[model samples]
Target: MPIRLATTADLPAISAIYAFARTQMAKDNNPTQWGKSHPPLDLLKADITAKHLYVIEEAGNIGGVFAFILGEDPTYQQIDGAWLNDQPYGTIHRIAGNGKIKGTFSKALAFCEQLEPNIRIDTHQNNKRMQHLLEKNGFTYCGIILTEEQAPRLAYQK
Candidate 1:
């Protein structure tokens, strides 16, 4: 799979992948993490405009979407618990796959790892599936960090 920055033209396909992820989250018993309006189209559009969004294409299909943003994330500045490192880092957010492809997260993580060793990501406390994937990918639990909505998320670092 080739990872490339997302363009406005990729919105529809990106949205579809996120939609599938939302549905799968519900089925996995993590329903409230990404509600109906979570990761809104406008936000995705903004990510695209900022060049922070990316898509993994496989067989001419957009298999996944994610945000790999460099520098310190404002939301992560204050953590309820401690972080693994206080050095400069990049954040991985809004990572979702179309379910049609396997190793999507792994591939994305590999890309991020290549870019920088100090990578951070967060997921809902109830998002067991994501937690497992993060740990499996060599991320260690850091602590809780609140999102823009004031919802607490489990932070991780590698």
Candidate 2:
């Protein structure tokens, strides 16, 4: 699979991937993280227009999507726990797979790492799968950070 910036043409596939991810989360007992309409079409469109959205393509189809923003995230400004470092970092958000391919997170992480060694991510406390993946990938628990919606999420850095 190859990762590349997403364009408007990828919206339908991206939306489908998120929908599948939401269902998977529900089955995994982590329903509320994305709820029913997270990463809404408008937000995803904004990400694409902003050039922050990327898609993993396999066999000419999109298998995964994610947002890689290289800058400080307002939600990460205040944390109940400290970060690994104060250095410049990238934030990975809205990562989801369409179930056709595995290792989406690992592939995304590797791609992001090539750009910035320091990366930050946050997940809902109930998202055990995400937490495990983060831990397994050498990410350390940083602390709790509230999302823009004021929902608390477990933060991590690597």
Best-matching candidate per TM-score: 2
| RMSD to the hidden true structure, all candidates | 0.8, 0.6
Give the poorly placed runs of model 1, Cα more than 4 Å off.
Answer: none
Per-residue C-alpha lDDT of model 2 across residues 1-158, encoded as one tens digit per residue: 89999999999899899999999999999999999999889999899999999999999999999999999999999999999999999999999999989899999999999999999999999999999999999999999999988999999999
In order, candidate lDDTs are: 0.92, 0.96
Candidate 1 residue pairs in backbone clash: none
**Tens-digit lDDT track for model 1 on 5-102?**
99999998988888899899999988899987679999998999999999999999999999999998999999988998899999999999999899
Give per-candidate clash totals. 0, 0
TM-scores of the models, in the order given: 0.97, 0.99
Best by lDDT: 2
